[model samples]
Target chain A: MIDVLTTAWNWIAEPLQYGFLRQAIWVSAFVGLVCAVLSCYVTLKGWSLMGDAVSHAVVPGVVISYALGIPFAVGAFAFGFGATVAIGYIKSKTRLKEDAVIGVVFTGFFAFGLVLVTKIPSNIDLFHILFGNVLGISRQDIIQTLIAGTLTLAVILLRRKDLLLFCFDPNHAKAIGLNTQMMYYTLLSVLALTIVTALQTAGIIMVVAMLVTPGATAYLLTDRFDRMLMISVAASVSACVLGTYFSYHFDVSTGGSIVVLLTVFFVLAMVFAPKYGLFAQRFRQRVYKKQLDEMSSPP
Target chain B: MTMTASSLDITVDDISVTYSNAKLALYNASCMVMPGTITALVGPNGSGKSTLFKSIMGFLQPSQGKIRVGGFPVQKVQKRQLMAYVPQSDEVDWNFPVSVFEVVMMGRYGYMNIFRTPRQKDRRIVMESLERVGLVDFRNHQIGELSGGQKKRAFLARALAQEGKVILLDEPFTGVDVKTEKRIIDLLLQLKQEGHTILVSTHDLASVSTFCDRTILLNQTILASGTTQEVFTEDNLTMAFGGLPISSLRQMTGQMTGQSSHIVNRQTSQNAEVEA
Candidate 1:
């Protein structure tokens, strides 16, 4: 037992010797926390598809930023924000529903990004941009991610109550003079920034999972928004830390490992949650049915 | 608790609203609600009742004309916290993870500081509002756990906590039990006695004459407006309901009245008194 324990400890401690691995772990945890916090709002507001659309839509912006020798986040945020605006504009202008508009706009932007990737010089690594390279992330990219993530976190925390009211009932929010339009734009902008923040850690293809899975898992476990927020942060941060360790040992993708863990947690919560889970619902129904049978038996 | 009487009245002057899709919702709609009175805005399903409410609350900008509260512009009145609105049940997400207490606490948002941290007074008022709606026991329960009537009562508690001089409720009685309906009517009457101006939009015509001091029959525009006794006539109701005869209208009210023995007795007594 002592030998096994020592081996496990060595496996954990050996990675800390490398500066890049240490930075990767810290960056992963930070990105997980920021995405998890915003995920609560995204899940509750029924904006999961919006998160997906915005994340995928940032690919062209990253390519453009690479071509122009500028910061990737600035260009990525612009396109992400622009995608949301275009979706809104088109939905208002045409008779199409929001989901259809989101589908068309995101696909068009992603296809345009693919074409740009093919035509650009080979200096840019398309694989890293699509699937993330957190283990090999640079110091500058880390700083950019942290700054964007912190700003998004601050705005969400400061305006938490009004945003909650807006998501729950926009009409009532307006009735209370809370400026629902401003709240709408604030939420959309922060969502765009959050996508940009997660881009370096989770990449465009996997970032939507980072933005949606934790909150969905937390939602199943609790019936209070405050508790839900805390649970999501805890779940996501732990997933990031553990998934990075596992990925290092197994030589696998870090973002993929973390998202897989998040999905597993969501499934566990869905099946076994105390109050609203599938098992609990079935258990309640069975008990009620037994009582009915007993009563019908001439008691 | 005695509420200070409000002397403010609501006036909508020839307001017209057109949606972004070029759908004209309301055209030249106008009405006046007096303070210290309960006025009913009666209309059909697609008759722009909600659009009118939105215009009055300044949620939708009217293409022409204006709305004023106590001789002040709608925007200025809103800034002064002079209005509270209760939208229909379908307008909210029931599955949101907010407690009944938290939902009612939202009414005090206008009174909170920048952080929206509730003061002791806000907590006390939230409790009092819950008590008023008889949902104090369910304060900590998630809103989705509540029954249909309980949900309506919770929203009513929120409106009560708002402490706005002018209250507009759209379809407050729909999907509620008779007991809850009685509770709502009683609360509205109490607010009327306190000199608050109330505008309630509902298709439930039976109860309009039971308590409302004035009624505005609406079908795209004001079909009739005056005291309930004058405007709630069979002809005006027929026109407003799109040619439903007086017999079916009475039957609708009668079927609704038959749901509760208490309301039936009171309605019969009131009808006998009217006949006498």
Candidate 2:
């Protein structure tokens, strides 16, 4: 057991000396951090389904970009953003329900991606875009993640009020002459950009888990928006570092390891955090019921 | 668009609204809100009070004539600095993760440049508006923590931050406790004193006479509108509620017996009078 552990340690420690591995670690950390921040509002707004929808909707763009050998992120962004805008437009102009719109657009995109994947079956990197390759993370991917993360932060900080109003009391925002359409698209675009940055290191499936779990876990800890974002980032960064380390030592898929790491953190938060955590919530309800019985019976 | 028409009044003339569901919610609604007064719009359920309020607030464009706010046509009066709206409820996602102060600061959106953040003056206005609503301590509290009444006050604070010449409220008192209701009414009265034109939709007939300067009674259309005393007459009340009176069906035939418009059952007519 000691020999096996030492071997595992040597394999992981060796990668630290290489620039490529360093870039992979940096990229994952940035993606995790940005996603954690953005997820605060997303979770609060009960749009927890957002990461699932937005990430899946980027499928067709990934297929097209790969087919044409173009910058995949560009195609993915435009298509992701286009799909988001289309859903928003349909929601605005038609009386159709939002969930129906999301389902139709997202499924259609996923199907298109699947078809592309089938066509490229024999390739070693065939489904790499979906599962990701954190082990093979590149310098260009790191730059891409960094730039998108920075831009996402900048936009959120700058238009904090407009975005807050748009999310909270949209009718009042409209009545006061805020262009609802413009604000809607601006948020969708930011969502698209955030997804694109996350697509590289964590990829589609695990990236979504990373995006949602940390924020949800953090939500168990605080009720303030700014603090929620901060805690989410902290949770995500911690998960990313731990997951990367474990992936290296265990000789497993980094993407899968990262998702597992995040899920564990979320479970811990659910059971342990104060007040609204899952276990605490149930326990509190029991105590409150007991107190009510004591007060009401013959009193 | 700003309502710079040298008057602070709203006038809806020959306006009609039909819902997308093909129901004519309003039929030729018309009224005038004079300057510097609180005009209470009252009616029974399904009445066009909310419809009229929506038309005046430019939320609904009428199919017929126009509704002007402060002499500025509804289409042209889309200026944030001159007009603000208070909804009955903040039904938007409470999970939106905004503090009360952040929500109120959004009132300055129109005055801001496309990429601009809130100015110091704008922040000050938001702070004062929060203070006005007695939610200064809750400025940094997440919206999810607020009770229903506090939620309404937060919205009102957002409107107050607009510093508008006019405020249009839609059933603003719903779900609010009586103490909070009175505080809101007091705040509206204060707004009136500041020369703001206030129009509010209400279902409470009892409170109209006490606080409102005038009342517009509507039932799918304008039934009667004028001072509270002028509009709440028995004749208008009958028309506003409906033509049939329950007393006509009551066990009393008393004096309404033989000289009535139609005949009653001969056997029950005498008993009805006795039971009267």
- Which has the greatest DockQ? 1
Weakest lDDT window of 10 consecutive positions for candidate 1 chain A: A171-180
In candidate 1, residue A254 scores what lDDT? 94
Give the per-residue lDDT digits (tens) of candidate 1, residues B158-258.
98888888889989999998988998999888888777889999999888878888877777777767766666555556677866766788676554323
Off by over 4 Å in 2: A1-14, A92-95, A117-126, A282-299, B1-7, B13-28, B46-55, B58-66, B73-80, B90-96, B108-127, B135-148, B234-276
Q: In every candidate, how many clashes are there?
A: 0, 1
Residues A1-299, model 2: lDDT tens digits: 99999997886677789776776676778788888877765665556565677888787777777777766778878878877777777776666788988888778877877787678533435456778887786667667667778998898888866776677666666677767668777777787888888887787777678767887888788766677778899888877766777777677787888888888888888888886788888999999999999999996
Model 2, residue A234: what's the lDDT? 88
Q: Per-residue CA lDDT of candidate 1, range A172-213, in tens?
A: 777777778889999999999999998988898889999999
Candidate 1 — which residues are off by over 4 angstroms? B1-5, B253-276
Q: What residue pairs are clashing in model 2?
A: A44-B95
Candidate 1: chain B TM-score equals 0.89
